[model samples]
Target: MNRTARLYALVEELRAAAPRPVTVAALAARFEVSTRTVQRDLQALMAARIPVRAVPGRGGGWSIDPGMTLPPIHLTAGEASALTTALAAVDAATPYADAARSAAQKIEAAMAGPAAAAARELARRIVTLPRPGDSAIRTAVERALAEGTVLLLSYRDAAGHESDRAVEPAGLLAADGRWYLIAWCRTRRAGRGFRLDRITAAAPTGERAQPHDLAELLSGSAAAGAVRPTALGPLPVAIA
Candidate 1:
């Protein structure tokens, strides 16, 4: 379209054709431009100190330095828009929300010119606000899951009882616009799900979490259903 956009596209084209000759006729026909225009554009590229070398012989044309890499990879404007839009659909209170935001930033950084602009426009149409300060707890849960670290938690039940217990963070679950941490309770010695909002405090126990897959740990099994009167905080409950 515009000369500036065309220049960027040309750079990408040459990069894709690196170490291999791309005849001026092909470049010109691909862009629907005259041979003179292609020659002038190549001359401008040379003037800009780009390493575009000429190939000799009947089959030879123009080629870029084999070592040169322009964008590294190609992500079209449409693809970028779709990815950001999908990220926008994640719930705001979960660990994934923070990660999605960070991913969106990286995607934006990779896109340039009109592609970046289009992605921003698409993003504006898909609005979401991640919960404030959610990263603090979310990071802890994610780290615990990743490193298999045990966690010491100060949690409150839905009925307003509070207690301190140790758990092994399993996996994160998002449902009904709320966040929940599914974990293996050391006290109850069973798997349970705790609402993230109810976790008043959490700290690492410096111990490794027991090896357990989230699906198998939670499959067909329930926590110690009855919380011992003397041990009210042992089981957080899966369906509270």
Candidate 2:
């Protein structure tokens, strides 16, 4: 590898070793370069908005701040193919408005030269069939999941009656080209799956629900044809 590439790899190694700080001297010794070269690499990382902090004095070195996002990976042909396939599946299942574009941008930024161009070209040639979903419903589900809020939804039942219901948003599932919210219902006192497209209105109650075991909730017994109703437990009552 060239000096620049070798330095970049060293930076990656240091970041992976965090939260343990790595000294410049150690990096120089590992790469058979001078401390000045290591310092230059650290500067490059800082310029790219990596949260690198330098500690002065003996036994001190550099560490990356936790929670800083890492740059995307540079993908080989095989890796690029795998990533595109997985992304395509996600895109088809959820059809998020921004996710595919954001992924493409990240992939392009991570790769270089012909590899980058080929990845982009392959992505363009690939297509995924999307399931129908109300973007608003999907957005509301995402919000509830992130905020841990209960949702008040206006839904159309199988009989086509539009009624309001309160549900504890447990999680989202995609099955057979449809999106379903697996939640605990306040009125029914049981878990239920609601179709995203049938949801006419969704409003967050601003009250967070108790934690639910996601793994058990999504296990084999909870599969599409399963009749198990109470997978985790009774959903907690609203906190007053």
lDDT of 2 by residue, 1-240 (tens): 565477457657777878888898888888888999889888977765557879778778998765665544555776865565456456533735445645655455556777767766776777766656566777777788878889999999889998888988877776666777888888887677788878898888789886665545555545645343453468778998
Off by over 4 Å in 2: 1-68, 71-75, 88-97, 129-132, 215-240
Candidate 2, residue 122: Cα displacement in angstroms equals: 2.3
Task: Tell me the TM-score of each prediction against the true structure.
Answer: 0.57, 0.58
Off by over 4 Å in 1: 1-74, 88-92, 129-133, 221-240
In model 1, how large is the Cα lDDT of residue 217? Answer: 61
- Candidate 1 lDDT score at position 203: 82
The window of 10 residues in a row where model 2 has the poorest summed lDDT is: 223-232
As a whole number from 0 to 100, the lDDT of residue 86 in candidate 2 is 54
lDDT of each: 0.75, 0.71
